[model samples]
Target: MPVPPPPADLTTIAHALQERLGPARWFDAHTHIGQHDPDGMTATAEEILAGLDHAGHERALTFAMHEPDGYRQANDVVLEASRASDGRLLPLARIAPGAPGALEEARRCLDAGALGFKLHPRSDAFALTHPDVDAVVALAAERRGPVLFHAGRGIPQLSEAAVALAERHPGARLILAHAAVSDLGLLAEPAARLPNLFFDTSWWHPSDLLQLFATVPPGQILYASDMPYGPGTFSAFAFLRCCAAVGIPDDAVREMVGAQLDRVVTGADPVDLGRAVGSARLGERSLPLERVASYTAVAMQLGYRGVDATEAVALARCGAQTTGTGPEAELLRYVDGLLARAEERLAAAADDDAPARMAAVLDAVVAGFLAATTSAGVPPVAL
Candidate 1:
């Protein structure tokens, strides 16, 4: 089938920017393509790929969304897309934090060719910094994969919480969606500090993006279009134009589009490649649970109060209190005990009406401990 071209204006935007910024091919960092009906997004994998080809993007990290039980449907659509694209669409599996068989499902997705895990805290009613986040992170790391987290500071959102959670997982590479726009002035400090941290530009206004562009290194910035949420090609082309308009170099734009994201999608650590992306932050800093708790308090006030939010806050605090220096065995035991308790809670909730809520809380607590332990000098990947 012949792929469609973008709108004339969009093509112009890309060409104009390429002329100025030098022609560096781009890789879209984020995208969601699917068909939705009562049966969830019913689009075939080929249709989604057709859209990608039509967009003129070299590659993309494709994801999907639907209600709770729609994981299967969504996964099927994405898996098909991944297979058809032959790696152009890096299929990512979306799993509600508290869904039954969530971990098992993640494994299944990876086996079926998902490149990473896709988490939407807002829609799933959980926070990235939730305690159980470690389990998912651990699973991804075990597979030598990365995780892309949806981040934004709006209704039912927890962009701030998601960033905080990434801080805890040093070994788990994180893709922060929308780059928390709250503190534009200080965003670079955090971006430069987190070695495994990456950001995607999808919906921010030209001004906000320019502000971010001035501070954040291009290697950390990914060109993304949260399709179905944004104006698709129009929005993506506008972002590219804005990047060029802001005087960002052409090579930088290329890096933003795909060079950097390609590394993350392929799970290639810059450090391993001797790229020196950045030194790990929170290394010398004591990321006590108190700091996380303080943020959670403010977050709750801002309406971040869901099962995942509350549980992550509590677990971070508890993790800070429980684990301390001693024999390595002792530390491991302590963590094991904490995880065991979490499992008990999860087991108990299996038959509960609100299994997702209960599971989210448990996962949040685990993620909290993992973050806290990392702050105390443990590798975020240790979990």
Candidate 2:
């Protein structure tokens, strides 16, 4: 299946929606500032800032990536970046719980101005139940700081392990990165049971976010891009799509986007910022809608046809409802029409290759829409 170009009117509607949302302040709760992996994942503070700027995020809680020396140097770099960022960047010291002097290192970083700490059990090769991890959690609890754990689809750092750890230190604010990635459903009960446990939106699947929003209290969820490692722009879009799909209230959306995290870090009351509507501001940031449209156009030009584009169209229509206006209703109908056409094309297509190709194109279009809406620079197309 080839990707079809989005209609010009569709692009215009997307832009209009972007403009209506206005400039939102996003605080990415999970981001890394250093490169320490064999997969060539590396980002400097400058690059991290650039990504943040592109995404219209005002601040991020960043930490060092995995390092060979127990993140000693990486922690220093994060501290330095945070010091120089004028509060735009908040440092979260990374610690290998099993390493010697880990607790002391965490204390030093906290005293040096780190707002929280991050632990990656998978990368550090330690279980969450380790005594060292307990010690780190204890320290964070004593200081009333947040601890972000890399809990996803794995043995040692699964959502269950995270729940057990959170249970031990009920006072500590523990964030489960990637929304517990593959185990959102399993963690829903624990998420509700543990008040100090929070989840971040960083995974690519919009469904996961939708489930999280639907199953968990809105206040317990935080907006995060996992920038410099994950697709920051796309992650933001996925979050938006989730909110739209779930019909999350505007005030709740605001809190999930940044306010909740702000309160956690600053101990301030969650301000009730009104809905993001009306005309856009001059020079305000926007997602890369044109790039997405162009990519879709190129895919269609290549003779691709599939149901994936139809699904994306449906998702966009759902997103239109978030605005709750007549114009948005009309836009939804327009997108529905496009979806019907795409479905017809998909039904008529005979080639088996169309599904995969169309899926890739739809994914790109969604990512592009996300980037365009938020004025976050578009990431390179995977296809």
Cα deviation of 43 in candidate 1 (Å)?
Answer: 5.8
lDDT score of residue 270 within candidate 1: 48
Top TM-score hit? 2
Query: Any runs in candidate 1 off by more than 4 Å, and if so which?
Result: 1-7, 37-44, 155-160, 182-186, 271-383
lDDT of 1 by residue, 66-102 (tens): 5555687778777887787777778888887776778
TM-score of each: 0.62, 0.69
Give the RMSD in angstroms, all C-alphas superposed, for model 1: 19.1
Deviation in angstroms for 29 in model 1?
1.6
Cα lDDT, all candidates: 0.55, 0.63
Candidate 2: residue 335 Cα off by (Å): 8.8
Off by over 4 Å in 2: 1-19, 155-157, 267-383
